[model samples]
Target: MSAVRENNPVLTAIQAAHPVLADDLPPLQAVDVAELAAMDFKPRQPLLSPWLCSQDLAMVFAPRGVGKTHFGLAVAFAVATGGPFARWQAPAARKVLYLDGELPGAVIQQRLWMHCPDVDPAPGYLRIFTPDLVTEGRTLPDLSTYEGQAVIDAMIETDTALVVVDNLSAWARSGRENEAESWHPIADWLLSLRRRGIAVLLVHHAGKGGQQRGTSKREDLLDVVIGLSRPKDYDPQQGAVFVVEFSKARNLVGDQAESIELELVVADDRATWRCRTVEASTFERVVDLANEGLRPNDIALELDINKSSVSRHLNKARANGLIKADKAARS
Candidate 1:
């Protein structure tokens, strides 16, 4: 009845024999390699130099209450405002879409105000969509459903350059975190975003052992993977200090791979909070000394730092798998 059916007698015969097979055949989309090679392709652009690049799918994981959301919001703000995030600089002010699945709108607003008290609100540059807004009359965006497609459509419609999913666990729907098969669909959807020149940042949780709480399959397609953890001697009143480690960064080289400490310093009036970066070598040294059979107090005296710093470093090192408890230390 159609040109394809009339021209291909064999295919017609096969379709005649099996009507269902005709419906199952996929359309062909083939490109010549030489033709593709001749076309001009844009070089990779960075959203955060040495950390996140355009078309990158990155993941940041941390244990509960370790400021994962706070840090993510800060980075999003930096990207939207075209400012420095920690030590990394955003090339220019870009539109960012933050999909919040955890915190309420009021809490998110409060945290944002504390981080940027003087910033005039720019709704066009920085947009936030909570779970209720995303799933108003539809289902959650699970990457395999129509609701997920709607989210992707919205991103494209908004011309968003960066999309931050507050957390994967809250929206992953029906997929078991530990199962590799569960991540296939999600990975494919994320890849689709990359193909459209959109960068994605996924916030995830760490397991009891401090590793990402899922199959490692998610990392296969990711360009960067970072982890966050609080110090062992974390004091609530001393401001929040946490270690940020680039466990995997496809773009970093040599010393650029080193981890850093992020501390949230409150102003004298406690009206504002600024995130600062500090060297994490003390923690590394503490791990090395502890592995070499020195006690925490001895390491503190040897490093000329305080006992609390030594303890905090040791705790972070152990959690990050840099060292294990020896028989001497276990006793």
Candidate 2:
């Protein structure tokens, strides 16, 4: 039998009968079963099992510096090597393919060695995408240049069961994420990969309005939508906690409950992340004050950062504080 016949009997049979139905044959280019599938697979359940037990196409959306990369790396290492995730019970370990679109290869290596020494990150198992750029600096493919199909092909070749895309914001072409058509290609590509049973975890930034980034289509394309937020039920310093909630899950059990807390810790030059519950209460208070009487630009000036940074941080801080905010005051 031919290779196609040996691999896919259905395709082989269809092709074999093609000559008989030549008169009724449709243009191959016009035939789009995949596109039809993509349109219909809006609410998919590709990822439902906890941890490594099942393949999951999930996303984590949060503001910057909220530890999405660190959190993802920890989870990927645990899944790759099979151990507890930051001390939580984890599923069986397997090889993980991490596509670091934002961080450099050297930075990624340093992070893994410093934070996850237990993980035996061999070249075969833990892969990195560090194509050379310029003599002055090296850079990975940005969102506009990144092709999900290419990454998928690499994953299949490497037998990677788990894949992580750090910061979807960086991987996607620059534009208004609210535009549906702009994200269609990336969404469709991700869907095609998810159908092949690879667990893909992507990190993205939550929007200014405390919403997930990208159009509603992005959420529809994902099997699991997980949100990271600080607990607004009380003052963060009263042990104000960070939380992980299953914003959407096809197979997971339980109410959208708090899955984990952001452990607050300081790191030195080693890129080490340590967590111990700290008082976000003060931060929350600052945000509440800002929302009530302080302008965002003023707050940013006080914090010595950009207005956009202040806006993002304030959204999260107010969220943690559960502060009812007025648009007029912030304006």
Candidate 3:
């Protein structure tokens, strides 16, 4: 009985600490101490560290069609399955569990397969859960219930390294994007997963105005905040591109001034993403054209910029909504 109870640490601790058990149970003994003096708890270097030395709770937000989901899927695949993400080099192989509230399983599968052609989903590795868990009535479900707890238990049981939740709005009980207080419970709940040395990334949408919905609460609790914007110069029909930027990082250097332009392409059922360089001057001009709702040619002449440059900027901006087109009826 003692051996059995010792194997289940959480329950054993609970039972041992209960007042009822205090009188009858054997007094707790301090276990032999190892070399605690050598343990290191310092904040880890972000770019070079694996496992983050601690779990990283990051909120990634972008407007709809900004490829937030696509970008998240790619990152999740890279981390869970192992690879080089935008800047972080690949770590030792680990499991990844993706929980998506908005995307269907098929769509998630498509994105994963596109980005990671070699990855597979079985009992433990690279699992995708699409709004399947019933977490209602609880701010965050206690995984104590088979469904709720099963995910975390599986994560621990399989030693999962990353868990990705796609889009914050999907599970928010309040459903009010502007209400920061309402998100506190959910954000804190997700952050708790970090205690176990697993990284948790939440996919969320920003307001049309470039601020994340529930930004105050979510941002305050997270260790990192990544924002993806559509390049003001990208075109929708040609392909999708995003301006990937880091809005916040507590444990690592925040990449406020650093930005990457990424383009997506799919062929032979595989998706490839490549990073490109953009001239700051030209990119800003494109943003100007987008904000003003100028046609490509008009923007070109207005800024005395090349038409091709205007087109590129316009496409990126439209995809990211650095500028929005007025509805035909409104126009």
Candidate 4:
């Protein structure tokens, strides 16, 4: 009846808009394994070398106040300019549309100014839309529904190579984060973007457990998931300092997925970025944990790493004289 149809928002929206429904869409194409292999599909080139690529769906997440926005903006600027960002290098300049949800207009403006004083984006190459840009009578569209998805889709141009959504909480307003099905509409929209050869960078929040917040379903379709963790003994005065860890990566292994420590230092009138790979063999963490009086088992638990890794790091710490024989025995 009318009441039942009204209860389904998507169906109502489609009816009102007179658009094709899901059932009306064409069937998915399929081919034999050999036909699929020999389809002559173009190789996906790196958008950011070794990790992010053309048509990639990637997510970068960090706990609140851990510089997720800073990292997101840096990547956007680099890709929009075909420049270097920390350790990642964009091979060439491409069009980008950065959609900001959380920050105030003046704040994002100042940050962009700090990062680029004179270098401007190429004409039509980089565009930005923030919540502050919406008129007083209008609100930013949510990405959790098909209607919301269509509104944002209209903003994306054909030439736009990347879309940076920073981030879920602000942009996707109605979803229940813990429910996997609640994320479906948004996930399907993101996949549709990938099918159109557009890459997406999702900046999300990390839960107290230091993992991406919400259902793991968000990561099911992602090609790379980068985690930003605040350094222990972190100094509040030192803003935007964190270690970048790639928890999930495709087509990469070993050093390609190594963690990098990055710091943003803005002294005088200029800003500078510093980055370096964390040395795995140093096992400096073992020394720190031992000095803090955490036993090997506790250390492994706290670090969320295997006990074998704890043992190996402890051995390395001992070899480096970071732990005395007696102290090492107890730790």
Candidate 5:
């Protein structure tokens, strides 16, 4: 009779009981800023001391064949065994989960063996899930779908502390890397993982300009961004040499962002590839450029130094047996 009251029992009861009560309720919950500031907070543990902290979202980007995966694996091994990696030290051993969207199982196994031949395999310490093996003939997991949920479930079940997505382009479904909006969903999902105290490392490709390929928004959410690149004159026969530069770091302070040079040494049998940190210098850069088949002029231009300086460094490098000069270069 009175406009049917919209068939709402709770509202009708509230209206009949106290007409003025609704106005007295606070619309939102409030917390005291002073109280929040007084609460105790634990500092996050360092996964890679002084660089990558626990629960940090980081990215390692590089051009193809520059050893991004190799470097990622080396770091993963260190974190899993509480060992040292390059110049960084692992504070303690932690569980690691590696999602390999590229590379076959056999190849991954061989690479692991090459890097860790002396150490015995510690199961559950470092777990790997390749697309071929995990999906079992089905399509790879799309992070936008139920498959993504399943992957999260697996991470939880395994008690993973660190998860490495051995590539963003491969694992991110429906993501238009160039479009900022397309990355929102994936970025949010990664942030959610960080919120839960899980660290995530994304391997990505670099553009021709030597920056991570994608919307700059990708870097917005990442705490650390590492760029891997081979020297201008990298020679496979000599050894695999590359640079690891910290382009962006939220935790690193002054001088901490200095670049690191890495060399992959192999045994006579070529059964092992051990990564070691090498000194970075102008002489080393000159030698590398020369070895890469760059002429003195080209090397000078690349290093942005005078041609005379290039020749001086070249002479010094040659005098020290650091580089071999072709007869043509001498002429």
Candidate 6:
């Protein structure tokens, strides 16, 4: 009946059997089957449904100049206002803290104004920390170190539910990019934040290989990992056309996992994005070989995906009537 999430079964059993030792027993430390099942812990609520949940850890990575900051700021605004951000909507407005190590104060202000020209943001609801605003020519604290974390931790108000770290390269400056061990401290810090019921969204840069830069170990503990890539037919003139794909989604399935083809149209002195669920699988590479009736193996080779994924997509395409089952069988 206690509201606390404390969960230890052996000690609980001892206290239940003998009330005399209840006061002397230490706090609960573990969860047993029955106790865990009976506990009244509530499910974590989403900041952005189907992706970011309370107490969750997530990341969005993209190549340089691919709109990582734009995406991060939009997410921050959406969470702060409880808004409809692309396909996701927050249940309610919540306090958010956004830390940016790269952009200037004027640039950020411009971006915020662009997002909401007529409406004023709720006061103190979305706190921002930019390197330009730091006092006495000091830089924003490095998130990879304890001292830096302490500084940022002090900046976070108790009511703040989400913290956005814009592009890890600038904030987490202490580590070697490719060394997995270099990211351990930052990873632990992120986990600690998650344990405290604070959700974190890390904006990141993509590597030369077109994936999240640095150690893959970072994804090992994350609840969601979004990768933004310019489409295969991407043109420099095309302002912001990127594919949003989930590389690691814990509970998402079926349509929830489909990649999004997002385009930002800037005209009439305004900027807004449009998104649609892509028809093909996330692995599709637009190969000329795929145009012909090729076997799954050949298609997989062209798509740079494994045989199993090719088979799965082929089945899904057929089931959705996007492709003919007979044609697939012939391939």
Provide C-alpha RMSD values for all models, in order.
10.3, 11.3, 9.3, 6.6, 9.9, 10.4
Candidate 1 per-residue lDDT, tens place, 104-179, comes to 7678777767665355436788887775564457655665443464454544533577889888887686668899
**Best by the TM-score measure:** 4
lDDT of 2 by residue, 1-331 (tens): 5775578643443344223465677656654787876664424221123532345678888766556777777677666665655334445556677766667667776766655644575556656553332236533444432343443353344356677887777666555688988776676556555665567888888888777876888887676787777654445453313556667776556532335556534355323333332234335544765756677776655545567766666767666765555441444
Write the candidate numbers in order of decreasing lDDT: 4, 6, 5, 1, 3, 2
Model 5 clashes, total count: 1
Candidate 1: which stretches are off by over 4 Å? Answer: 1-34, 117-123, 132-139, 144-146, 268-297, 300-331
| True-structure lDDT of candidate 1 | 0.74
Q: Look at candidate 3 and tell me the lDDT of residue 75.
A: 73
How badly does each model clash, as a count of residue pairs?
0, 3, 13, 0, 1, 0
Per-residue error for 156 in candidate 4, Å, reads: 1.0
lDDT of 3 by residue, 1-331 (tens): 8887678655554453233546777898754447555555544323214324347877788888878887777776665555665555556456777777766557766776788736543446677666544357633423223233333444344366677777666645453556765565465456556656667777888885797875476677777777887655466875677777767766555343366777778889888777655455467666765566666666676666688876676566657766655321111
- For every model shown, what is its TM-score relative to the native structure? 0.73, 0.59, 0.64, 0.79, 0.76, 0.75
**lDDT of model 4 at position 218:** 88
Candidate 4 backbone collisions, by pair: none
Error of 2 at 103 (Å): 2.3
Please list all clashing residue pairs in model 1, or write none if there are none.
Answer: none
Deviation from native of the Cα of residue 96 in model 4, angstroms: 1.0
Which stretches of model 4 miss by more than 4 angstroms? 1-19, 38-42, 117-119, 280-331
Candidate 1 positional error at 300, Å: 6.4
TM-score of 4: 0.79
> Where's the lowest-lDDT run of ten residues in candidate 4?
10-19
- Candidate 2's C-alpha runs over 4 A off are 1-53, 86-88, 117-123, 130-139, 142-148, 155-158, 231-241, 255-257, 264-331
> Would you list the C-alpha lDDT of every candidate in the order shown?
0.74, 0.59, 0.62, 0.81, 0.75, 0.78
Ten contiguous residues minimizing lDDT sum, candidate 5: 269-278
- Please give the TM-score that candidate 1 achieves against the real structure: 0.73
